[model samples]
Target: MLFNLSRPPTALRRSTSEFLQLCRQLPSARRALYVTSRSKTMSEPKVISVEGLSSSEANVSGSLRNAPRVHPPALMASVAILALLRSESNKFPPSTIIIEQYRPPVDRHVVGLISEGESPEQTAIRELEEETGFKASGVVQSSPLLVSDPGMTNANMKLVTVDVPFPENLEMPAQKLDPGEFIQVRIVELAKLRAELQAYERKGFVIDAKLDHLASGFELAEKLRQPKSST
Candidate 1:
């Protein structure tokens, strides 16, 4: 872009006195300032040309002060950071389920186990015999299994449960049970299972997954206990 300046008088070169006088009247500053009287705006030094210079020789200089800079969103970078933060830890929680098998369609008086190798449900039935000598009338569908102490212990166990009808009293076949292993057989009422869960939670005991599932099936035993609900 060429700037138009008033033509210089042909006597310009010899008039050093006049140029020096003009320079003395101009103020010097860190940044050159150009005032546009037409728009009342301040701008950077722009075009400059010698009055006698041809348009081809004119100079156009623009201020490099301002130009907007844009950047990409940081979320992409943060999402990528998750991979670096992933843990190298192997610590894992234990899992197990506690079960009590019932006899037929009765209370949730489920069977428990005494040893391993027997299907966990088998242990439940065996415990029924050892504790009360009652054969599990039948097995429930898909009883829960768990690592009761996923955090601290290695007891990977499952609990199988069934409903047991009340006989004259809880009876154990002495021959089938390791009499030395079991000390007591207590009959917990259907109403007490929820309290039992609360107790386990208070103690920070992980409910055996097997028992958790069993509990779901056995839910509303109290409702079952209501005489009106029964057929």
Candidate 2:
């Protein structure tokens, strides 16, 4: 994240001059600005100088402003499927796809990147089948478009819930993962989801943020549905 500015870039030099001028307009503004920006994300502010700035700096200053918006690359976009297994006992438990892989140092949900020319729902269905070996009859619910780590990256995802009918033989299907993908599927009761995630964490396995949030929401809803004890 460090930027070398020995001979500062055109935009940077112009921005520095403009910022300094604005700071000098008010009493003690320069000191305040220096402390706020430097102490937070910057190691040193000495590289920023307003000593020699041309009048043309004003014209180019407008271009230095951050872009109004950015579109995430389609290749980086993904879909996460929440697959619920419907059993004969009328219990619809959700299956958590634990990714035991090399890259993420932790476990994740049933998620896959949207391939070229593929829709979000299609990606969801394919991901469920490939990661957990369960075919989604249909999408039960679709969440709003979500952006994970907005501060860091603009990558986006769609979360869809699907119902998977349990087989009569009660045997889980074999997973059809892509090359080098290692995943384990577990059907967990909704009530025990949070506890299961906590247990995984205790065993030195970190839970994905999105999955953790889902489990926490379930736990919160269960608590709120219970009657309060009398004081």
Candidate 3:
């Protein structure tokens, strides 16, 4: 089933923060959140806390579940796509950019949230189709775990690309965005991206944000910089 792509209730902030503070240590913990810990000795169930942080996720999940407007899917894997394109003007690239989420009521990055039974790759393709409304073929895969903004949430994201020609076949119903996903996508060329790394407006910035998350971002970005063969 498609995961509930909604915001956690306001009350859960304290809990989320507490748990993340702990699990931020382990390497896998970067993308995965703390779930539970099995208590060794007990007639009662063992206490589980965030993997690293002093607190665990179960407590938060239980509390959040009982809270008003709070649903399940307490911890979920969020997958996303990165689209690259070659414009008509130049054989090379002006740049590759990830489309920002369409926002109104709430604000979120544009990512393909994987369903419970679905694969991350599927989520990537499905999300791209819905968000961009452009039926793309051939999705190149990369390492799945992502950590652009590690300080905020322990969100597990992925990077994938579907190339398309630019200069205007891009038709997307920007108005019909998943609720809460606000976006400010910029189709920045390599020169600009290189010129202003720090100053780049991260209105849901895609490529550079997850600098550490992606070992390949720099390498791939370089390929985009080179002029493509016209053959």
Candidate 4:
């Protein structure tokens, strides 16, 4: 479900000094505020003060029946596509044309958040076209929602793969990025994806977790395909 972040109530408001004093007063697990939809505006947020409960019990679940848990109004989810194109030039050894891009803050794959009524596949196709100007009829594969950082946030993403035909003439495709999107596209060879990621990191670019894991998967597959040495 989608959620809109709003300010907390005035009663719950506490200054930095007041909060520090409260922490000193409470000698139990840190106090946490869990957002819940109490009404239309979601104004009724429950403050779960686990001053007596143990660390594990602090995180409420259905098992508790009455325990209150933090449920954000909206979940952070997106679709990340691994768009691959087969080049006609190197049909012998097989070449996978991986479309990547670099923007401020990080180097990431073609990704975007899923709109209110759009499916994951639709998000992938739209993002692929919008970010790289490459159109796909549909995705080749769509994986389940993969959590990017469960410990930090409820943010997750669906990994999708789309296969598009690389232009035989090897012409660079144009991007149709929205305003404020200064994305620099890079066509990295699949065989050297791992190396390219390392090189990108060396240049002080923060690599997205999805892209890093994808490159590592390729490297692992390559090693698995290699023949073992004789004993």
Task: Per model, state how many residue pairs clash.
Answer: 31, 0, 9, 0
User: lDDT per prediction?
Assistant: 0.32, 0.55, 0.44, 0.55
Q: Model 1 — TM-score against the truth?
A: 0.31
Better of 1 and 4 by TM-score: 4
Whole-model lDDT for model 4 versus the true structure?
Answer: 0.55
Worst 10 residues of 2 by lDDT: 1-10
Tell me each candidate's TM-score: 0.31, 0.62, 0.45, 0.62
| Candidate 2 lDDT score relative to the true structure | 0.55
Query: What is candidate 1's lDDT per residue for 22-81, written digit by digit as tens?
Result: 434544220012121122242532211112222222476433222211221221100000
Q: Considering lDDT, which of the candidate structures 1 and 3 is the better prediction for this target?
A: 3
Candidate 2, residue 28: the lDDT equals: 33
lDDT of 4 by residue, 19-53 (tens): 54664565322222211222233354342111222
Ranking by TM-score: 2, 4, 3, 1
Q: Which stretches of candidate 2 lie over 4 Å from their true place?
A: 1-71, 74-76, 91-97, 104-110, 167-170
Per-residue lDDT of 210 in model 4: 59
Q: Please identify which of the two predictions, 1 or 3, would achieve the higher TM-score against the true structure.
A: 3
- lDDT of model 4, residue 3: 11
Query: Could you tell which candidate, 2 or 3, scores higher by lDDT?
Result: 2
